[model samples]
Target: MENVLSSLIPPHGGKLVYRVLQSAPGKSHLDSLAKIRLDQNKQMDLEQIAVGTYSPIEGFMGEEDFRSVINTMRLADGTVWPLPIVLDVSVETADQLAIGEVVGLSDEQDEVMALLHLEEKFCFDKEETVIKLYGTDSLDHPGVRMIYEMQPVLLGGQVDLIRGRKSETRAYELTPKQLRRLFDDRGWSSVLGFHTRNIPHKGHEFIQLKALEDENCDGLLVQPVVGKKKSGDFKPEYIIKSYEKMIENFYPREMVVLAAFSTFSRYAGPREALFTALCRKNFGCSHFIVGRDHTGVGNYYDPYASHRIFDQFPDLGLKIVKFDEIFYSKKLNQYVQGNSLFPEDENDTLRMISGTQARAMLLRGESPPVWFMRPEISSVVLDSVRSGIQVFEG
Candidate 1:
């Protein structure tokens, strides 16, 4: 059948969506919708779509929120799960979705509105219905999907809604060009992007420092994920503060740029790591530091799998700073390379701590080793936990 996107956008300009679809095939319309009901959650399956103008897509189409349609999926009981397809959007598509329009979607057959549910209520205003949609592709995320699906609306919202906040670290909005220029000016000959929700532990510090020293990269972009992380995670603002404090205290001001990555964490591990690099590349990063279990949850991915992706990255136009996992070796009494057991420190062996272990120790009112954290920061974190006030909210 003719692609549904063809009917949705200008004949000539809808080609990008067509390209995206061709690269990632969508499920049939029937299957897509069924999977939505079955999952009882919104997901971007390739099949679902929304119609709108161009300008709106640019403003409202976000990777954090996009409502698309996909194919139906089935469960063991033979229950059907319709594919949760969302409309994917980008800056260009946003403009197309909002040409001379206030609301992007149509009410009639040619431009019918897709009813989106948010917070238990249905809003007919197409502009307010964007929700997070998950898909398998690394580069395409809810933020990117929103840009793809609701760009026209978001472009409008970008001006209309001004109250919701981003953290201070990301508060200074830089044009894409300015961002590129900032990297160039800083001698960030190779920008290496690093994303995390936690404060820097020794392992993270070790690997990042190694990137600067070993890889001879010009600079590092300490981009922290400041969006919806799982519960028990640090708040974006807190993370921003932590990074700011660390940079001010430890890292050279000229060598690093601390910025907030305003996207939620998917914990997709290796794929997520690559996606992070591509996003940074979009922001002018030439290199990305991929640590062990970049975004893995529950031991699903091999630690080395995260770095192995670098092998294929040359074909993908992104470079990575791959290092063996840094860990604290109890026997050596210091951190050692994951691939080897010898102490990294020639004289004083100081084992590094893991984020997971740090969290576990903190919840129990224990101080993480100095090698794992700064004493002052760890004290503040522990005190916050003890007060029943969570310093970090995932």
Candidate 2:
């Protein structure tokens, strides 16, 4: 039974989608793409689809899929895809392109990214997308703001990655196939995946360790998002270095694997949490740890919304390990879940530190106490801050 459950979950549509051009196109084909350019977000989306990171999605969503996903959180074919990955282009660009035509995707520097085979061009209801996906249409939400800023036109079709380039985080990035092979090679049948965008604190470690033990899993995967994030989030380099130090000196190395996930953060709170879990499921994780305010931003979402959202998707194909908020208990001299503590006098100690406080402390040249964070990890952050490194620069 364990072996059966350990078998990798299939890519959403029962096969891994790789739409990249296997061989170089002719000069004529190349010339066609030179006429149009794609932005960084679309480039990233194409790369993701080509590599099967966003498997089951062969290309950008068509009008049918887009409308269905916005109204029902499923594709037109009834596939349970929560997020719509459509390529938005300006009206002028759309005017120059037509169905059955192909366009070249490029970056700001004129570096070719992909060739989009246009299948459909349509307009989306931005207001509806914001309401359905984010539960609010207010521009105050980053995801909503992004939609409002995008061009009114949407391009739908398959993409042939023509000029894929290795990313700086490539050293830490692992495809689904590679990760599955790693898990098999390590004799790990049940792996718990933990996703994070910020530096890991003691609470984070406590939850990960506890989940590993409670689930009696074979290993833990510390997969951090290393793509475009809000300005105040931890830098990819700092996040990677800190985790390396923490895993080497603190964690049981044999039971843990660290990798980077390159994907943009939508900050859609609960919906984003579900989307992330599906990605991890495709990456061969048998279980995922969902903590308090998982994938949330500011106070837009309920504290336990991420946990509750799991109830709505009973067939997500991945086990969700729900964890309560963890805080330091001075009486116990260790981290404990919020519900485990007994009532005590005002003098009794139970304190929790926010990520904001941790960052502020690091920026102030102060290290979080050993109880709240490992010295090695905090030291790396301190060093980066002292060097005047802009850890959150996009």
Q: Candidate 1 has what TM-score?
A: 0.58
After superposition, the stretches of candidate 1 with alpha carbons farther than 4 Å from their true spots are 1-175, 329-334, 342-352
TM-score per prediction, in order, is 0.58, 0.93
Q: Mind giving the per-residue lDDT tens digits that candidate 2 earns over 14-103?
A: 666667677777876676563556665666777778777777787888999889977877788877778889888778888888799877
Q: Tens digits of per-residue lDDT for model 1 on 237-304?
A: 66666677778888876888876655555444565666566556555566677777777645456777
Alpha-carbon deviation at 280 in model 2, angstroms: 0.7
Q: What lDDT does model 2 reach?
A: 0.81
Total clashes in model 1, counting residue pairs 3 or more apart in sequence or in different chains: 81
lDDT of each: 0.49, 0.81
TM-score of 2: 0.93
Residue 374 displacement in candidate 1 (angstroms): 1.7
